[model samples]
Target: MHKNDTLNPELKHAASTESGFTLVELVVALLVISVLAAGAYSRLANTDTQARLASLQSFKATVLSVAAMAKGMCISDPQCDIDQYQTTSSTTIEGKPILFTGRYPVGLAPHGAGGLDQLMMPGKFTIQPALSDTNRATYFLAGAHDERHCKLEYSITSAQSNPSVLSVTVDSSGC
Candidate 1:
């Protein structure tokens, strides 16, 4: 064989084989990656609404628990009345010492219980006996962060038949 044509068939074939992706392949790969990235971003972006709704639900549960606990205590202990647990101001609920502040406790956990930490949004809480009747009470908790907002209303009535019945409503119009 001539000196210039020294390469074996296997060597020539290996040399001629392409080592990199074609332009179309690279473009398709990039497009796929971008689509995946956009999907991930969309999924992540939708979480805010879900989170706001969850916060509302959690706040509603907290309010309900507070009402239930107060009702149970009022029913059992003559000294601890439902009115004592009422919070008319802006303050965090501190268990035992002050009964309830802006928040309510679920268990024996100290201060700001009922998943208050989960309320990453700004909000308010209030508890008061119905002006019309002393045997009934109302609890209100609301949160708003930007366009996301939630409110929870809880009412407890003491009746001769049921003793205590809790009614709860959750509003997520802003969320």
Candidate 2:
């Protein structure tokens, strides 16, 4: 019955023992949670950026593949004219279905038989003659997804009995 003593032994024991978490423990837990939350937020913010970069990389690869195929065809026959197969739009490329002597190298996603429209970013690709005395053409591939737009430009030059020359450039920006 003293000021510090109670009739119930359990209550007295608990008061002296201190139950649940201490102030320092609570603060540490909160700090750990805040750190994890911040990491997750940063990763989410970078998701768009990662997608944009991947699109650019894929676009470049597709363009290069097409160019290589064209070069191979030209090599087989010195008279092979790539200009005959050149297209100004991806739609035309899609419509053609076949280039050189095989199916189109680029396939649209989900729709295996379709063209670049099935691509990850769903963009346009064009093969146009670049103004040059050499048999050189430029491949322009562009795609837009979310807040990013990626463009890849690749050029191929033909030379009889010689390896075809290739050049590529890429650009990706916010939409």
List candidate 2 segments past 4 Å from native. Answer: 1-8, 22-24, 81-149, 157-164, 173-175
Q: What is residue 105's positional error in candidate 2, in angstroms?
A: 13
What TM-score, over all chains together, does every model reach?
Answer: 0.53, 0.53
Clashes of 2: 2
lDDT of each: 0.47, 0.46
Writing each residue's lDDT as its tens digit, candidate 1 over 95-162 gives 43323222232212234433222222345544432321222223344434432234554444333343
User: In candidate 2, what residue range of length 10 has the lowest lDDT sum?
Assistant: 101-110
Whole-structure CA lDDT of model 2: 0.46
Candidate 1 stretches greater than 4 Å from native: 1-11, 79-149, 156-165
